[model samples]
Target: MRIASLRQGAAVISEAGAHLLPMPVGDLVTLGLDRALEVGATALASEPVPYAEEDLLLPYRPASVRDFVTFESHVEGVRRSVDNASGVPAAWYDAPTFYFTNPHALYGPGAPIPRPASSRALDFELEVGVVLGAGGTSLTEREAGAAIFGYTIVNDWSARDLQSREMQVGLGPAKGKDFATSLGPWIVTADELPSLDLDCRVSVNGSLVGQDRLSHMNWTFAQMIAYASRDSVVVAGDLLASGTTGGGGCLAELWGRSGQQTPPPLEPGDVVTMEVEGIGSLTASVAVG
Candidate 1:
């Protein structure tokens, strides 16, 4: 089942339309994935509301956000953009690495993303994210896989100039990325997604910019989750993102490919739309912060 958060409340989307849930999505998720699915199913009996895209909100506020770089091609492309002879770091192949991001900075479908005032080189990363329904510490891959509740599209916005400088000091991507992150359209339950091999695409101001497949990731979501849970806890509502896809998932990767910025960086009034095959499209307009 597909669940969406609206100004009214949580909703279950069906062919007929969207049905409102009795409680908010964040609360439903706390009931655990199975019980949440049950609640969603029960909500289907309520009168349906027209599926108005503009009325949607972040599917649910994330408990915490952890983004991982699991795409080898993306890593290689980005590295080459920085240093001609560079390739994926040898350490990168040893484990699934991720960074924590601000969960409060999230925006939903149709929201306007604020470009940080300090950035002139803004970019977007197209990715797929999974929301967890169960929590655990030192989880096994199979256990982590079972904890997944559903999936959604994630637009991990970036400030290239800032990210570059901070990472050089060996510590960040912090201020560069803390400004904004767009998520939603809605979340499709794990059972609803039979395969991870889905097409992913992104566009800027109605012009196609990048395209790739979810299957391109070298490491699976389960592996990323298990790695994250190593002696630490990941709880319900936590979000984990599959880093940018290769084949032009982000402007940085594009610049890396061409050895220079081709299309200019995002400016005010730009519209970005990111889509994943089974989930849906997530669009956000760019605005000066």
Candidate 2:
């Protein structure tokens, strides 16, 4: 079933139609988790309020967006273009590493992703991930799998100049990547997907920019969750971002020539759409002053 969190409020899709959920998406995911688990049923159904998709806010407000460097294509793309290197360092394969982002940074699809005047470079990072369900630490992979509710997309908007400046201090990305991140239309249960081999892509102003398969990820979701939960709890509404994929994901990589240059940078009129094969598409337009 497809579940959406919007300004009008939480909702889920059923045979009847789009139904309003009893509570907020985060609250529903974090709150009633134990109740749903206790029942041991396929899903929790509810009556939903009518809200226009465009007018609706969105399901973000994640407890946190724990980002991990797992997609190899993204890694390679960085190395070959942005990073002053050739490939991922030897230690990258040692284990999963992540950086946490505040939940308040959440934005919604169709909403304007601001391009700060403070810096001329602003960009998008196309990503997707598993939504962790209610649970505590020490849960085994089998248990983690059971706790998983579904998946959603993220546009990890970045301030390139700020990120580079902060990285110079060695603490890394601090307020740079914290400015904004968007997620929505909704979250779908894992049962809906035939396989995780979802084909995903990104387009700007209707022009294709990034396209690749999830099969290319250096690390899979199961491994990411297992490694992440080594000792900590993967809570009900906690989110994990599967980083970005390849080709033109961010301006940090597409700095020079290669026949790809976003001059005038990203103006207010620009529209970017991200598509994940199994899921659907999310489009966001750049807003100007």
Candidate 3:
């Protein structure tokens, strides 16, 4: 089932279209979305509300956010673009590697991402976000798979200049990435989206820029979740993101290799639209600080 958190209330999008549940938006968050779904199932559904009429919010307020780089093509593209000596590290193939991001910085669909005052090289990452249901430490891949609640589109906004400088110190992307991370349209339950193979695409200001298939991922979401849950709890509402897909998924990868100058980095008033086949599309406007 498709679930959306709106400014008005929690809703379920069915073949009949968007039907509001009686539950208040904040109460749905406090009750846990999974449980809210259960309650909404049997309750008298209200009249279908046109989706565009209501203001949407982030489907889940994540307990924590973890993003992983599982696309080998992205890694190779980065190395080639930056002229780095080392390719993807040998240890990367053995285990999935990830970094924690600022959970408080997440934005919903239609939100504006302000270009950090310190950054000029602004970029967007097109990805899929997996939201966990409940799981404990050291989960097996199967266990982790069962713990998944749903999926959503993620646009991990990046400040390439700040990111590159900070990585040189081997510590953080703290200021580089903490500015914004966008998710939504709505969350599609795992049962509704059983396959991971989906077409992912990105466009800026009406022109297509990046496109790739999720089937090409070198590491699966199950593995990423299992690795993340190792010796740590992955509770309901925790978010894990599949990193950018291959091809020209981001400006850093595209311009970095081709030296193309026609399409420039994001500027204020630019609209970024990201779509992953099953989850849906998310669009955000850019604003410079």
Q: For each candidate in the order shown, give its overall lDDT on alpha carbons.
A: 0.88, 0.70, 0.80
Which sections of candidate 3 miss by over 4 Å?
A: 22-37, 81-86, 259-262
Ranking by lDDT: 1, 3, 2
Worst 10 residues of 3 by lDDT: 78-87
**TM-score of every candidate relative to the true structure:** 0.97, 0.86, 0.91
C-alpha-based local distance difference test score of model 2 = 0.70
Tell me the TM-score of model 1.
0.97
Candidate 2 lDDT over 7-74, as tens digits, reads 66566755454566555667666643445333223334444445665854666466667888777656
Error in Å for residue 24 of model 2: 1.9
- CA error at residue 274 for candidate 1, angstroms: 0.7
Give every collision pair in model 1.
none
What TM-score does prediction 2 earn? 0.86
Note the clash tally of each candidate: 0, 6, 0
Root-mean-square deviation (CA) per prediction: 1.4, 3.2, 2.4
Q: Rank the candidates by TM-score, best first.
A: 1, 3, 2
lDDT of 1 by residue, 1-289 (tens): 8899987678998989899999888888777789988898789988998867888999899899999998888888777653443677899999989999999899989998888888889899999999999989999999999999999999999988888777776775788898999999898999999799999999998999999999989898999999999999999999999999988899888888778887678888988999899998999989744
Residue-by-residue lDDT tens digits, candidate 3, 172-203 = 46787888999898878787877788999999
Q: Over the full model, what C-alpha lDDT does candidate 3 score relative to the true structure?
A: 0.80
